[model samples]
Target: MAGGAIAVAAVGVGWLLWPSPSGRTLPPARARVYTEFSACLLSDSSGVSGKAAAPVWAGMQEASATTAGKVSFLAVAGPESESNARLYLNALVARRCDLILAAGTAEVAAVRARAPALGSTTFVVVGTGSSAGNLTVLPVAPPAGVSAAIRDVVVAASERTSPH
Candidate 1:
């Protein structure tokens, strides 16, 4: 039994040391050259100055720092209504943002409603909600997760939307 145990241990260690079949070593970790992707953040009544939207804004800021792509944030400074939401969505599309980060239910609905007209821009909703084509809803809570989710969603969308 002891001899068998030794053999198993040796096999495990051997496997760990074994080189890959191709014999090509992995390159050192380096900063990635991400294709340029623009994003816009639309907040509700809180906008960027209020406590409610601060976490969301900070999260996006961090996400922007980690990527090579040019990411931006835009907070709607006025009260949120369907009409206002439409205006902001239209403006974001006009600004040529590939992704839109809608910060509340109102923003999500506005984006969802307008998604048909703007075919290419992907709307990533950062709060609890449902989504469809060109719209991805991520359930957000506690503020910190919002940033991480935003980064992940943006990265994934960038990969999908980028041409080969």
Candidate 2:
């Protein structure tokens, strides 16, 4: 019985230390994936929209490098104008993107309007509403380290609103 117990303990430890099936000490960071063959990136003229897309594309690129597939990008003008929004969305649909990265409130609204026809495509929005399907909303607020900046803005707004 003691010998059997020792054997079992050795087996458990061996399993715990075993490398993954790929024979690597660490698992791969990214997996190969398939989608609708294009990614539509919508950003506003203020450039915040483009900034928001950077991290996502970087992560995807890293994954593609480590895995067995490729990723593509298609960017469109996402200015505050409704006309620009319509043009951007139409172009994205024409490109047949499987994912849409909407960078602002206006872009989110425009994409939500056509999401039904988008048909299971994924939509990621930065700083926008929450009602659209397959839409993941990442809200942006002032960071904790920027409390002083926020206070300054509030004071400025109050001064403007208070009087002559």
Candidate 3:
């Protein structure tokens, strides 16, 4: 794994549900459990299928597996605009996502715009984005490096929010 970076914005700052051998897994489907921390994604209209977003999503799933965390995503609706992006971001915020991931240019921009006021809910912009306040930006890592880059972010968030 190579080519990874984590920058704090403004000089600051899952998918499967399967029980691991040590019980640190979230089942992909049936019989889900509260993972204590949830990381949600705000992707472009292309959603998970987009090339840029897929690796990030995969990294997120890897993190979920390691942290026993929950992962979910919402694809932005058509007509890419900040206003529309905000709606999706608001929905994720409303869901009380412990960490909100913004992948894709549009999604990252939306996160940057709203992150300052959101407070406490960590924002991760995975790609070419600027880090500020509560937002953290990660490089568009290569396929081999996604897991390592994402593992740190997700695990840290999980530990910070987890009660047990």
Total clashing residue pairs per candidate? 0, 0, 14
- In candidate 1, which residue ranges exceed 4 Å CA deviation? 1-35, 49-52, 161-164
Tens digits of per-residue lDDT, candidate 3, 2-82, equal 223333332333113334567564547766565779999899989888876787788888888787899999999887888
TM-score of each: 0.67, 0.48, 0.76
The residue pairs in collision within model 2 are none
Worst 10 residues of 3 by lDDT: 6-15
Query: 1-164 in candidate 2: lDDT tens per residue?
Result: 99999999999999998878977676577755542234455655543325555554454444334332234554545347656676777776676555566655566677766676676666665564674566655555433312232223223323333334
- TM-score (C-alpha) between model 1 and the true structure: 0.67
Candidate 2 total steric clashes: 0
TM-score of 2: 0.48
Descending-lDDT candidate ranking = 3, 1, 2
Segments of candidate 3 deviating more than 4 angstroms: 1-30
Local distance difference test, each candidate? 0.72, 0.54, 0.82
Q: Per-residue lDDT tens digits of candidate 1, residues 77-124?
A: 576776777787788888998888777666777887888677777887
lDDT winner between 1 and 3, please give it.
3
Using lDDT, give the best candidate's number: 3
Model 2 spans > 4 angstroms off: 1-37, 46-49, 66-75, 141-164
